[model samples]
Target: MSAHLLTHGIIHSTTDPYAQALLVRDGVIAWLGADDSADRVADPGDERRDLDGAVVVPVFVEPLARPADARDALSRGTAVVTVLAGPEDTGAAPADEDVQTVVYRHADRVDAEAAGVWLPVGTDTDPATLTGLLTASTQAGEQAYLVPDGGADAGPAAQDVALTALRSVAEELGTAALGRVRHRLVVTHSVTAEDRAFLAAAGVSATVVPDADGVLHAPVASLLADAVSVCLGAGPAGDPWAAVRSALSHPDPDERISARSAFAAATRTPLRALPDAPAAGLSVAPRLSVSAPAVFGVWDADAVAVQSPDGRVAAWSTDTRAGTPLLPALDAETALPRWRATWVDGRIAAEDVARDARDGATPA
Candidate 1:
């Protein structure tokens, strides 16, 4: 990733705005200092990008609109902000806009206790054909259906009805539409706290910002951030565990192991550890034996044993549960538990020894 510096702009960092310049490196904000102090802290090889005195507010750049810009923003550690506009209001294509608009309408109905429905229209089909298609689809279990130009024109009353119908359909779908359609639900105003909690519990990300009147701002940031996080495999705010899980599932085994290890360390939950003698006192060194591939195992007072598939026995302090594996500890002199002991052909490797005292040869 290329490093750059954005200078002479009103930059928003979290909740505060600063007049100083921000040094960006590898897509993160490396330093934020006064413009005059740039020479003292700025990297010599960084590319300087002047903001032309514009207020550089962070806006969530959509992948479809301009992916490179989004990448740049993420690299710069910019907090993505989104505007909550109804899908129909956004003027996106018909097919692409339905899901978003449906979600928005459902949220609106829930907030205002109104009714709504999805109005599907074919761009190339005439009014009669559109109505026929809608009728057929509705008969085939599609609810809250409407044909554009056949039901009603775009108006407040018509919109209300449409929204109400859409909400009904959403309810019928039982939240499955959310996953299937990839729609985002954003609350644009200060809703009841109970509603907010409900949304959060439902795994819907939301942001509450205050308006000029001290009212909470619409949750545009949440919606945009959700989209960005989904694409980047980063979890939404207030949910770091999901992101960690995603990192653990990375394709690269090394990355997956590293992520799992980090997670285990942070949570104080020992995962599979290498088999080795319990360290002196409270500290224990896990070692992988030469006879077995390094594997994950749990340590307790009784024993340290290898997990299934890769079976290597190491010393254990006590009995513990077998969960995930942590990072592998490497040392030249110490022999660690072989994780791949079980995978050694038809019989266990000659050097591999079962720590009967610890686990009693019980396969984890």
Candidate 2:
């Protein structure tokens, strides 16, 4: 594999403006320097991609990936952390070997190791059992990602369930391992001061779901006024970007976050669980207009060129690259390899339609 010489592009070793040209070899950024040194740094056989001048950033990461969604995300330079909805969701499949996949399982009767990652047990799961799982995780050096047994409810009933459940976890995870969990403890309706205190002590924070009004302004305001570092919870929409946009422009001053902070909540807030950080140097692109959001599209047309680890220069969503969507709007089901008909294996096998588990499982 030849080293890539990227020139005339705005390069960001840390998303800051101090760097210019960069050399990528074997998928890791091998070197970074000024644009004028291209000749001095060349290996003679290296490839050259001239960046007319676009902004370069790392790849976007999407969490809770469903198997069906992995391929497209990978193609668009997004890596995924997939989940198993339940015992039924355990197992990994023979996936597109080119894509990077990480599988996680929800607590259930099945062994999480069968798939690779172990999620926390539900609130009802016995304390002894919870302790065992957590102890094993820390001993093995895998941090925990959890889904506690209750939802957000500013009301005491929900709080009771959540608090009790969380207490069970805290006792087991202990002070040290508790920090390993994602900071935000998502709730069903609201967060009481009591709930907030416990969460804070555990080195965690809470995010509340708004009431039926579909507005999170009041809850957000309430959370922040307490002098707590807080952010919006992705309500039913399940899209954090939408929530940020809405919460930032909220009419209620109390509920709003500044546009800059809102953007960080959506993009830069690190991944939820962390025994590991995102693979270094991966990046993202924003939408296709000068005034477009800098978070949707994935490349700096003028300054940066993406080189996938596998050596494939995945194309943009549109035909020309000046400013295009990294992923074009299309149906994944019908859109094939531009040559789709040949791979149909005898009409959807009866075996395919009724599988026991989702395909995040590795093949037998």
Candidate 3:
């Protein structure tokens, strides 16, 4: 049975236009419209999330493959997540998120065989193991990710090495798409043309990620256009929202884009590179960006539902419902109290609150 999360007053959506209310099911937006219409069509047993005028946006997510990565992302505002490995320590679901892991990278770092089908193609890898993994995944119809700057030493995946790997595969099969080569890889420290070309020959694409600094630049920004997408780095500086801010506020005025486009770069734009990703989304948040003047200071913690593929929904809406609240946007401090009454998900889950017993042990 599909569920629903009805929100009214304001919405900043990508797929659906401004409406009084919308529906969510299986963690994805399912319907959008006015309150009366939502009431008329809503099936019984659907979850009614009144929000109490507080915002209710989709959970913002960050993609990664490590436990340490999740710990860092939660500090920022990454809500939902798409990770490569499940939690090893706390079962804590971040403040408003659910963890979705894919493959676990080896903690040992230098273990090339540990990479398996998702091969990290940098100089640090054991040449024989890397070659075998790539060849096997190619023949088995499984997707193989080429991590350029991955390995025990953690060196950037050399552009030359990546291209050479692809060239060998392409020559062996006479085509990049043949022998189970679907065309894709995951790169670190930005991407270069030769790397993109080698994978392109096999009809593969890549996801160009940033270094610890949280920046994804062009050619990496420009070359991997077809199937390439940028990640909001999962390192300490990795914040998807920050990634949106950066893309929207690119230093060069000529390169600057809209808040919505920056968001796409964080989530939707990466879809092309994620041929293996689920049809549903990862992390989602309603609009509360300083990038849009009207939405600024709103602190509308809720997310506006939107689909980047359509490029139609308003980033901010002007139409207002007659009885909407006239209250000022709540700050983080005040929001906590009201949350107790309306925190639909796990209220005491790992991160909501923690008692720091170590601080005042025995009344010291």
Candidate 4:
């Protein structure tokens, strides 16, 4: 966090020259000016380093084979952590290297294992042999990474192999394992349009690289650690049961019933029928006028059944009816609302209903 002055050479930021003399304070560049101008303002205790005509540019150095260097890079605020070796160099044992060591330590915290290993398929290699290798690897509890080889082209071939390996591993492991695998692809030099299309078809995850240094040696283990961090860092987005509760409050009687059924299906809980109330204020009340097909009577109370526009039967209490009470105004509401005649033998058959002398009782 202290201030420092760097002078004497061209500074490159990205692929272009940034400045001649750069002044950095609190890990940030305060000013970039001429070397003489920079020296005039330099503080008494400010650390100064001369570049001696060498290019002073930011470069990433990965420490896969060296733990001390990685730690030092981390202390210096390096942006990327890379591993430059293959699995063999790091040892297949999982504990000899930093990446594998971290993964093994974190594996016990989560119920599932996370990691994927991709092997590029070549033109000369038999397709079956590559598949078999992927299957064997997945069966041994390791996630496979795959890339496809597009014919005789070496670049495409390597990518195809990587894709094939990843897909095979995912399929062999099933859904539970699929959820845990760290999906990635491997490419020979650069990812091409054909390589991308192959990846989309295969449904595998990948990272393209030009050579071995681009390949993260213990990618599976490294990915697993990252996955754990991400999982632990994320918070719940919203309440899970909000939609079910809203559906139950729907205004339409049919929609309300449908919502209850849907909720039951989703939660695997048995639903109970709503108790019948006075039919007077029910939303499904029938109407009568020139629209009435015919007048049907219910003798227990002042009510009449009318045929709805859709040819379904409905009843309206005479007290709530306009023009005239269907039968005569009675002390209580009419017969209880019941399920449609067609659904009598369905799930609502267990409910009871009252009958009038003129019209038969219907069970819901």
Identify the candidate with maximal TM-score: 3
Q: How accurate is candidate 1 locally (lDDT)?
A: 0.29
- Sorted by lDDT, highest first, which candidate order results? 3, 2, 4, 1
In the range 1-364, model 4's lDDT, one tens digit per residue, is: 4555667645432212234566656434456656878877778787785534333322111111122233322122121222212333432222212111111111112212223243445667676777676666555555443433431124555555555555565566663453343333443333444434434443333332112212112122122223211000000111111222222232222222222222222222100001022112111112211111111111121222332312233444343223211211111233322211110101111112332222453321
Residues 249-304 of candidate 1 have per-residue lDDT tens digits of 33333223233232322222111110011111111112221121111122111121
lDDT per model, in order? Answer: 0.29, 0.42, 0.42, 0.31
Give a tens-digit lDDT track for model 2, residues 1-364.
Answer: 4455666655434332344566655434556667877668778887775544544433334433445555444334333333334556544432554334555555454453423344433445565665566556544544444434432224444334545655666676675555554333444445667656666666554444333344553345455555444534444444443444455445465556543344333334433322244323223222111221222212323112222312233443333333321211111122211100100011100111112154332111
Backbone atom clashes (below 3 Å) for every candidate = 41, 30, 30, 24
lDDT of 4 at 108: 15
Residues 218-265 of candidate 3: C-alpha lDDT, one tens digit per residue: 333444353444444333355444445444334344444444455545
Listed in order, each prediction's TM-score against the native is 0.29, 0.53, 0.59, 0.32
Q: Least accurate stretch of 10 residues (summed lDDT) in model 4? A: 229-238
List runs of model 1 lying over 4 Å from the truth.
49-52, 60-153, 170-364
Segments of candidate 3 deviating more than 4 angstroms: 1-5, 24-30, 35-61, 71-97, 104-116, 124-129, 150-157, 178-184, 188-198, 218-220, 224-234, 250-258, 269-364
User: Sorted on TM-score, highest at the top, how do the candidates line up?
Assistant: 3, 2, 4, 1
